[model samples]
Target: MPNETLAGLTILVVEDVTSIRSLVVKLLERLGCEAVCEAADGETAWHHLKRRKFDAVLLDFELQSDDGVSIAWRIRGDDGLINKAVPIVLLTAHDEARIVEAASKAGVDDYLVKPVMPDRLGLRIRAAIDKRQDKLDRQARSTEVSWKA
Candidate 1:
């Protein structure tokens, strides 16, 4: 990857706690991300998504109004929303197998346990973005190949 691969990427962080929310934002900024949009609850996060676009969403498992699993499900199942394909990374304090399995089933691209390390989170974000971009590139190439064939 380049020195500033995520230079202009935007991240949406949904965490109910003020301190944790700030920490995630700070970490994202340190990783060269351009903007960090924050939401104190899942409801507010949904509102933000409706108004603006984000490259990825980092959601907390437990929110003041709605949980991350529900949020993930809604985003994945809601066909009317344009940001449904946006990669979601669930951040939670639990490391249980059941919770992880549930998150996976809910369409979360990745999960990170609480007290997230800045380096690890950055790596996850990079991998998710690269994977998504690769899929898009492949689809575009296929379309072009079909048109010329």
Candidate 2:
């Protein structure tokens, strides 16, 4: 059965390896995502990011042309992106502490080590989205308070 929270979300899956990318896409579909976009590299992923708004991003830590941290940084920093504050779940084979720290610093909302299990993937994605939403909510509240002050 599909998860209710993820049922209607549009997601972007970025991975260099064909098989892994396919697996991730299938998993997202199984979770009932409304739309699943694919990108084999950071460039393509950036193109998708700029052109479309995704509920969440599943980004590979190591890509042939670019790294997930850099892409995450770009997403967080780029004002031109349709979804600059979109939730990002970094998928990586590396479980190193330094890498995790870097990803956190880059503004990734969650991190998952490969091979990703369906249950865990769903949890991570949902968590990331919730985290982003919480931040947005807090920011909005702050802005409103300041405006009324």
Which candidate's lDDT is highest? 2
- Per-residue lDDT tens digits for candidate 2, residues 9-92, read 999999999999999999889888999999999989988988899999999999999999999999999887787999999999
lDDT of 2 at 42: 91
For candidate 2, the per-residue lDDT at 116 reads 94
Models 1 onward score TM values of 0.86, 0.94
lDDT of all predictions: 0.87, 0.93
Top model by TM-score, which number? 2
Score candidate 1 by TM-score against the native.
0.86
Residue-level lDDT tens digits of model 1 in 1-149 = 33354578899999999999999898888878888999999889999888888999999999978899999999989888877888889999999999899998998888899899988898887787777677678878888843454
Q: After superposition, how far is residue 129 of candidate 2 from its true place, in Å?
A: 0.3
Residue pairs with backbone overlap in model 1 = none
Q: What's the lDDT of the predicted structure labeled candidate 1?
A: 0.87
